[model samples]
Target: MRVLGVDPGLTRCGIGVVDGAPGKPLRMAGVGVVRTPADADIGERLVLIERGIEAWLDEHRPQFVAVERVFSQHNVRTVMGTAQASAVALLCASRRGLPVALHTPSEVKAAVTGSGRAEKAQVGAMVTRLLRLDAPPKPADAADALALAICHIWRGTASDRLRQAVAAQRLRTPKGTA
Candidate 1:
């Protein structure tokens, strides 16, 4: 499966594309950051984010999009920008009719580094090793994006299969059955 992982932020939204399946070797199709000037108006920054994400969608054509779920933070301004950028990613994927998954930062860390509280450096190192890259992707955000993709490829595929199985089983059961 091909996945585009988005680590959304107003100043530097990270974007990465990875191709893989559970128990299979992974490949890094692409990785980069979408930067918008910090001084730009909120609406303009969102527009830039939208365009950047759209371009990635056009180029990578991922089957799924995995985005970092926005969580509460002490800095309201930072959180607000993150949430806005995240919305852009969600919008872009939905417009393309692609499946989108939101994974928490801890979930991504756990998937990549075997610890929910793993440090950014650890996650970056693990991402590099997992993808067989010569070095960790820069700016922490970039590695985080790749980690999100890896996590989804490892976990989302199984979750999807389980959901399908449950639906299929329900269809097979009688309507009046519990």
Candidate 2:
């Protein structure tokens, strides 16, 4: 399965693509960050993000999109921008009819590293080792994007299967049944 992971932010949104199956080795298809000037109007920044996300979708044609779920932060402005960028990613995936999974930061950290509290450097090191890259991807965000993709590949697949199974069982049961 090919998965595109998005770490959404106004100033520097990270994007990464990975291809792998549940039990197979994962490969990095692409990784990059989308930058929009902080001084740029919010609308303009969103437009830039939309274009960047669309380009990635066209290029990777991922079967699934894994986006970082926006979490509450003390900085309201920062959270707002992140939520906006995340919406753009969700819209892009929806338009393409792709399955979208939202993973929390802690979930991503736990998947890539052993601990949910793993630091950035630890995540970066793990990402490098997992992808067999010569060095960690630059600008932390890029590595984070890759980590999100890797996490989905490792964790999301199982959840997807469970959901499908439940749906199938529901179909097998009578409409009035519990």
Candidate 3:
């Protein structure tokens, strides 16, 4: 499956496309960051981000989109910008009818590096190693976006299977108290 992972930020949102499945070698289709002027109006910045994400979606044609879940930060302004950018990403994928998944930083780290608390450098190194890239993606954000895609491709499929199995079991169970 091909997944477009988004690491959303107002000033610099990272976007990456990865193609692979569980137990297979993942390949990087593309990776880049979308930058918006810090002084730009919030509305304009969001529009810029939306347009950039749409372009990536159109170009990569990913079957699924994995976005980094926004976590609260001490700086409210930063958090708000991230949340806004994230919403734009979600909207883009929804409009295209692509399945969307939200993965937290810790979840992506754990999936990629076998530790929830892995450092950024570790994650970057692992991402480089996993995709067999000659060097790590720059600015950390690009590598982060790739990591999100890698995490979803590896874990999302298994999660989907588990959900299906549970649904199947529910269908077989009669209506009664457990």
Candidate 4:
């Protein structure tokens, strides 16, 4: 299945698309960022975000979307913009009746780099390796977004994977086993 991962920011939103299948590597469909003017009002920026997400959804047709959950950075202004950007991403996914799951930053980092506290550069490095690309994914923000997507592809609950795990366990156990 195709999953779209999003990292929402006030000035730039990161987006990554990956296909998830058990025992198979993540297929990097695309990676990018949606940039908004720093001086623009929040409302207009939100509109741009919404349009960008919608465009990605229409183009990629991902089965699901995973977005980074909001966390306050202490600065009220920054927090507000992150929230708005996040809302636009969620709204875009909801509009298509797609199930959207949220993952925390630490969770994304751990999934990508074996450490929850991995730096942005580390995450970018692992993302580059995971995708088998020689050059790092362009633009730090976009690269981070792609890493977030890769995290979800690795750790997100996939129905088929779950079903297969259950089936395997059942076969290994005796009848009526607990």
Candidate 5:
């Protein structure tokens, strides 16, 4: 499956694309970071995110969008920014009629580095090795985004999908003990 992973922020949003299946190495399609000037108004920053996300979707045409979940924080300001960013990212996927999956930081870290406590550098190194790339993905945020994509690919719920498909098929059949 083709997946678009996003690490969202008010001033800088990172995005990455990859194709992979469960228990397989992810093939990196591309990685990019979108930046808005710190001095820009909040509205302008949000607009930038919306446009940048749309452009990425158009270019990648991913089958799924994987996003980091926003966690509650002690700092109100930090929480607000993260919440807003997450909302916009989800909106972007919904607008495109794409399926979205969200994972926690711990889940992504563990998936990328085999330990939830793995440092950013460790995660980056693992991402490079797992993808068999010449170099590590640039900008820590972009690396994190790529990691998210890899995590989703590795941990997707194929069995759940199968169950749902089976239920739909049963519904289509006539009432009988087939």
Candidate 6:
């Protein structure tokens, strides 16, 4: 499966593409960041993010989009920007009729590094080793994006299959059955 992972932020949104299956080796198809000027108006920054995400969707043509779920933070301003950026990503994927999965930071960290509370550097190191990269992707955000993709590939595929199986079973079962 080909998946595009998005790490949304107002200043620098991370984008990464990965190709892999649940029990197969992974490959990095692409990785980059979308930068918006901090001084720019919020609306303008969102537009820039939309454009950037659209370009990535065009280039990667991923089957699924994995985005970092926005979580609460002490800094309300920071969380607001993250939520806004995340919405842009969700919009872009939905427009393309792509399956979207939102993975929390803890889930991503645990999937990649065996610890939900793993440090950023540890996550980067694990991502590097998992992808067989010569070095960790820069700016932390880039690495985080790749980690999101890896997490989805490892976890989302199984979840999808389980969901499908349950739906199929329900269809096969008689009506009014428990």
Off by over 4 Å in 6: 161-178
What lDDT tens digits, residue by residue, belong to model 1 across residues 100-160? 8899999999999999999989999999999999999998899999999999999899676
Show the lowest summed lDDT stretch of 10 residues, model 1. 161-170
- Residues 6-124, candidate 4, lDDT per residue (tens digit)? 99987889998888665688678988999999889878988888889899999999877889888886689888888889998987876555667788989988988899999988988
Global Cα lDDT for candidate 2: 0.90
Clashes of 3: 0
TM-scores for every candidate against the unseen true structure:
0.89, 0.89, 0.89, 0.85, 0.86, 0.89
Off by over 4 Å in 2: 159-178
- Model 1, global lDDT: 0.91
Cα RMSD of all models vs. native, in order, equals 6.6, 6.0, 7.1, 9.3, 6.8, 6.6
Clashing pairs in 3: none
- Against the reference, the lDDT scores of all candidates come to 0.91, 0.90, 0.90, 0.81, 0.84, 0.91
Model 2 per-residue lDDT at 25: 86
- The order of the candidates by lDDT, greatest first, is 6, 1, 3, 2, 5, 4
**lDDT tens string, model 5, 17-132?**
98989866679998989888888888888888888999999999988888988887657886787788878899888655567788898899999899998999998999899888
lDDT tens digits by residue: candidate 2, 7-123: 999999999999998778889999999999999999999999999999999998888889999997649989999999999998887655577899999999999998999999999
- Which lDDT tens digits does candidate 6 get at residues 26-136? 999999999999999999999999999999999989888899999886589999999999999998886655778899999999999999999999999999999999999
Question: Candidate 4 or 5, higher TM-score?
Answer: 5
The number of clashing residue pairs in model 2 is: 0
Q: Candidate 3's residue-wise lDDT over 1-178, tens digit each?
A: 8999999999999998999998999999999999999999999999999999989998899888899999896489999999999999988886655677899999999999999999999999999999999999987899999999999999898665554455446556564552
Collision count for each candidate, in order:
0, 0, 0, 0, 0, 0
Clashing residue pairs, backbone N/CA/C < 3 A, model 4: none
